[model samples]
Target: MSHKPRGLRPDERELWQRVAEQSVPLHPERAHPVKQVIERLNKAPAKHRVQHFTMGQTARKIAPQHNLAPHITDHLMNNHVQMDRKAFGKLKRGKLGPEGKIDLHGMTLAQAHPRLLGFIQSAHGQGKRLVLVVTGKGKAGTGTGPIPERRGVLRHQVPHWLLSPPLGTIVMQVTPAHLKHGGDGAYYVYLRRRK
Candidate 1:
């Protein structure tokens, strides 16, 4: 068999070694795509990340502050404008059914607020005496974030809203719903009769 060069000559091998050492690698170690994205996000200031109000944030922000006057229905009675004990008892006992019903679940405060106001106004205009407003027992929101989570925001707000200016004029009384009418998740709104 003819003799062949089994290996590179010493001079050629030395030249190849120098070239290999001097040349850049074909592919430098790339940072993982996810890692790169995380790094870029981390470089941003914290203020920018929380710049705008989220839906929950807006809801919590606009939620009516709790008031004691509305709750003390018996103490400061508005006899002419408020529901009488007999009518309120009938409502609480589920003897009187709602003439109309409106569900405010899945709606943010901005949406619910207007919708609630409109419903009350329309119901009053139509001569509907009693109505049901269902504001669901909200989910237990996460409290770990920068904004503290508030539960049952609508449940609290509906009563307060019903007792506020425009709505207060039309709404005669607001009572928690009976078990048959959604219990704690709803309110029995008694509207004033249009003369």
Candidate 2:
């Protein structure tokens, strides 16, 4: 290999060094608007719809299990860019207390299965519209991040279990509750009212 001018001659390097150090400082006036930055990032995901199921599709395709009164269900089924903050806020404030609570902690799927089903039926029979099943934030079962259910075991399986035929009419839809109600750590399980 040819010897590239050994590094640059001192004067050549000095000129480059001076040029490198001279960065036109960011002018506050030229800074990008927050809206512009948000718009650009929002556009990126529109192209990658596979990864993000739009928190943006309000139609039937997005929320098949959405079943409440017509007006109420429509409000809940909103998949706008942001969850309907107002509706979520109201639900959070509203104390639709669970008829009973089940600690699914350390319980294997086989054990929790029947228990969960029975719990739903009892709640439904008792006219319990809301049931709080303590999946324990799904954290104890796996040592993953905050969304503990993403790991093997409970996280991957619970939704399927709930959606199957027996539990199908039992649970309406599961959604992350407001911060006061445990937020993502726990789900607000809306049970179907016994007619």
Candidate 3:
């Protein structure tokens, strides 16, 4: 059976009133802060009035803020050329054929690192000048998180790997591959002459 609502007993009601009267509010201002804010907002003069427009008028557009880092291609392009200018131009134009090539498309970071290091070392030891590293354009991520995820993991990391220890000393220039070689997915790695 459902219980019916009942009024507080006279003794209980008196006890409640006594307790309430004796107790102090921890945050008196917070009790009605929302109401205070509304009142203040109502009293303040309006700073930004809405503009009137006709039915067919286009809405004003705001320029988007660019918070993300620059593209990997831009970074590589901006880096000072370490090799010959004439050869660099030829390399960029796909004139210089890669003597050695490595495909690290589907490999994890752990797997790709050691393989990349060894490949570069071997290529340098064999007296290869230009090499091709194929790291396919990574899959798109769900743009749900606060910090945006970079598209290609290998594409971004490959440049850094070439520039860091062991490989950095031997590697002369690193550039994005031309369309025929593999657009943004591959790199043209030029190695220094063996000493």
Q: Highest lDDT among the candidates is held by which one?
A: 3
Could you give candidate 1's per-residue lDDT for residues 86-194 as a string of tens digits? 8877887999999999999988888899999999999998999999999988786655666555567787677778889889888887877888999878888999889
lDDT of 3 by residue, 70-104 (tens): 89999999999999999999999999899999999
Cα miss at 169, model 3 (Å)? Answer: 0.3
> Comparing 2 and 3 by lDDT, which wins?
3
Q: How many residue pairs clash in each candidate?
A: 0, 0, 0
Q: Write the per-residue lDDT of candidate 2 for residues 48-136, one digit (tens) a residue.
A: 34555677576556422222333322333463423245544555664555556666767788998898888878878888766665554
Model 3 collision count:
0
- Which structure is stronger by lDDT: 1 or 2? 1
Superposing all C-alpha atoms, what RMSD in Å does each candidate have to the true structure?
Answer: 19.5, 21.7, 18.5
**lDDT score, candidate 1:** 0.80
On TM-score, the candidate that comes out on top is 3
Worst 10 residues of 1 by lDDT: 68-77
Candidate 3 has its poorest 10 consecutive residues by lDDT at 59-68
